[model samples]
Target: MVAAAILASAPATAALSADGGVAQPARPFQFTVIGHPFRATSDENLLRRSITEANQDKPAFIVATGIKAQTEACSDRLYAQRRDILDGSPRPLVLLPAGSDWAGCRNSAGRSNAIERLNRVREVFYPDNQSLGVRRITLTRLSANVKFRSYAENAYWEQGGVLFATLNIPDNNNHYLPEAGRNSEYEDRLVANRAWLHRLFLMAQRRNMEGLVLFTDGDIKAHVDEGFSLLSGFSAKQDGYAAVRKQVRAFAEKYQGKVLLVDSQGEPKATPAITWRGNLGRLGVGGEWETVRVQPGTASLFSLKDADSP
Candidate 1:
């Protein structure tokens, strides 16, 4: 476990600010990545314990890729419960809503509209400009000039000499549905996402950032072994996955800096699927990129060190 090294060398209290805020440490700082709770029975206790443990660890911040419930009906109560649990975390939490949270509800037995569910997600999860959790951090989202100004879920921030960005790339083939307006929505979000990627790379290049991290709820690099990727293509009108991979890869190559891709998946651990963890970071660096399987009561710890350090 990478966290073991951090625990052995660094004091647990190193990330706690004197004023009860998150400490703004120098480069080589550590943080936590939490995927989502399993889609089993509706058990909030397990999630509460995970938050408690993460708070005890005291990382600089925490990021939850997305949450999923396997129940037949997508209930608003479930979403609200998940949001409340996230807000209870003692550290700052960055959440990225994914397909399971909204997309799959479209045309389901419950007959929920995808767009409406997405709107509800934003309304409930992103009620404020600041992030969830007790420790709130202001985010830089797409301003009024952007087409999807209501998408306050996308955000970017700088930390410890690195540029961290979260995009609203849900796993449902990016909403490339055949229905009317679905294609337009997908296209618009795609354009916005592309622009976001370009801007992130530009910021890194201009600001001389040491590394860049782009995380989302969707697994852009899904392969044949992953079952979720199979379902994504059914809703795609244009080849969104290919475009995203190409653009992000090109940027990483051009930047010639360490880049990390952190995402969450809905598949349970018992299923035989592609391994979530992989080595896609700067070839020689220790912690470049990997997927964290964050279940109830468990979180992954990692540090962002200068590319050439260690």
Candidate 2:
């Protein structure tokens, strides 16, 4: 069956109370997250199989983190092919960009072509406010704001009383360059991401959401230093994720609902795990596809399940 038909037949999350004057808490809902599936250029089959498997499970939607593998050439043809594959998915599929998708890109002349490649990627994948799949969902892109008009990839939507958003933080050290005066791309994106995060948090708060879920290519907490750096005295290696980490911590402190950050860069493991720090939680999907079941009104708002688990 097509994704739309399947989704239509799925159980509803919210229902009216016995009095018919108030609504009961939303029931649990599942969504699939496909980690970096393509390890090489020839791994297209792997991606196809992942999508097929995800469809069988019939999650509300599917989020594929990263389009192409590091080994894949940063070519327009490849990007187009991958976009077509995602568009074929029966489920609503959201694509998140990874460092491999464009950060390391180079022109034939051996000069950095990262910015151009990233723009091309955006044009190919984010053609509209809807996801790339047979079944679609409307998204609120950061580009809606005039100041951040170029960031269509950063978007958010509400599902099952939860706020779901995507931040374009690539895995290669957040795509930070050590060289001075050459970080226009990284710096600009950081600013836009901060603004997007603030907006997402404010919206969730205003709407009294059960929780806020963020999807990104890199783990924001992976390289963050919580304590003083002893090696370089008070100074530390330039960590691109520092700002985001700090912002998340501050926001989570005041927010009454749980905050979950999901990323694709983790070590390969049989089962994925979520580590919690107070109200903030982090889940790394690694190199395998995983599904998260979000249960409202539970002590743990979210739980991880293998994609193929029955």
Top of the candidates by TM-score: 2
Task: Give the per-residue Cα lDDT of candidate 1 at 277.
Answer: 27
TM-score of model 2 vs. true structure:
0.87
Model 1, position 62, has a per-residue lDDT of 75
Give stretches of model 1 more than 4 Å off. Answer: 1-25, 39-42, 106-112, 143-146, 178-182, 222-239, 266-310
Q: Which pairs clash (backbone N, Cα, C closer than 3 Å) in model 2? A: none
For model 1, residues 189-286, the per-residue Cα lDDT tens digits are: 77888888898899987765555667776667632232333344453335457567667767866773456676665344322122222313411111
The RMSD (Cα, Å) of candidate 2 is 5.4
Worst window of 10 by summed lDDT in candidate 2: 1-10
- Give the least accurate 10-residue stretch of model 1, judged by summed lDDT: 282-291
For candidate 1, the per-residue lDDT at 207 reads 60
Candidate 2 residues lying further than 4 Å off, grouped into runs, are 1-20, 39-42, 222-225, 228-237, 304-310
Measured against the true structure, the TM-scores of the candidates, in listed sequence, are 0.71, 0.87
lDDT of 1: 0.60
